[model samples]
Target: MSQTLDLSSAPAILFLFGLSGSGKSYVGNLIGELTGCYVYHADDDITDEMILALQEKRPFTNEMRDRYFPIITEKILHLRQHHNFLVVTQAVYKQRHREYLCKNIPNMEMIFIDASDAVISQRLTTRNGGITGASALALRRDFEQPDSNIKVILNEGDKSMLVTQLNNYFSSAQPEKD
Candidate 1:
């Protein structure tokens, strides 16, 4: 059977939770194409200074996350006033941060795109200047697995196959038509 996403069934705001290189951006882009929801990448809008810091081999600090959260929050709120969204961010590692978003965004839901540590490590090597294995391990350690309000937990698989599976999942999760 062909899998399809029922946009109406989708939450107004959806956050994809995963470590870096877990295909959040790729899947988000697919969702954007299949659905008209605007997909925003928090890192893409980082300040130049942050970019420079990254160039200097300094990873994003907690202070930077605090700074970006409000900015991205405001942008999401503004855009949400006009459109639905699929926001991709690495912020879900923090419970309090995720709570803030849950409280602020209406009809929001979290989706955890999970994969094994080995898989994440392998995928990292394919990207330019990807996260170090140690960093990935750190994220793994600091990761607070969410317990509630999760719409779905998708496992990492073949990109194309995963997309189709997600499409079907989203479609099937819809409430029945009247």
Candidate 2:
């Protein structure tokens, strides 16, 4: 079965959430390029303390995320005022965090980037930066899967396949005719 994304409303905020190596950043950038939307990597908002914690192989506690989420949401809100469309990439592992973002950014649309364990492992191993090893394991164990109603993009194949999937998903939408 094929998945279709309804872009009729042209969401103000496109939130892409997933595991560390699930291709959220790649897909978000592609979406931004294809749609002329601004891409904001939420990881850029991570505090130095959080970076140190990750560097030490410590998984972030809910309290840590609680302190961090507000920063991201605030920036997103501020950016939305300037840009009509925004593609945001963040590993929103907790359901409550997702809910908080939705409540704070009412026009946001959440899309989950789905990738198998083997694929994620391979990607993380080859990637130069971001979470990996024990931190990645902790994230996988702690991740709270979102509700089934949310849209998903399975990124198990090669980059071309992933791009094809995104292209089909985005190209199916009818562009506004001025």
Q: What are the RMSDs of all candidates, in order?
A: 3.7, 4.9
lDDT of each residue in 1-178, candidate 2, tens digit only: 2433344455678799999899899888866665677999999989887888889887888889999999999999999899988889999999999999999897888989999889888888898877876788876877999899988889777556665665554554545769
Model 1 residue 81 distance off true place after TM-score fit, in angstroms: 2.2
lDDT of 1 at 64: 67
Q: What clash count goes with each model?
A: 0, 0
User: For candidate 2, which ten residues in a row score worst on lDDT?
Assistant: 1-10
Q: Check candidate 1 and list the clashing pairs.
A: none
TM-score for each of the candidates = 0.76, 0.86
The model with the greatest lDDT is 2
Q: Against the hidden true structure, what lDDT does model 1 obtain? A: 0.66
Model 2 residue pairs with clashes:
none
lDDT of each prediction vs. the true structure? Answer: 0.66, 0.83
lDDT of 1 by residue, 31-120 (tens): 787666688776667667666655565555667666767777777788778774555554356666777777877787777777776777
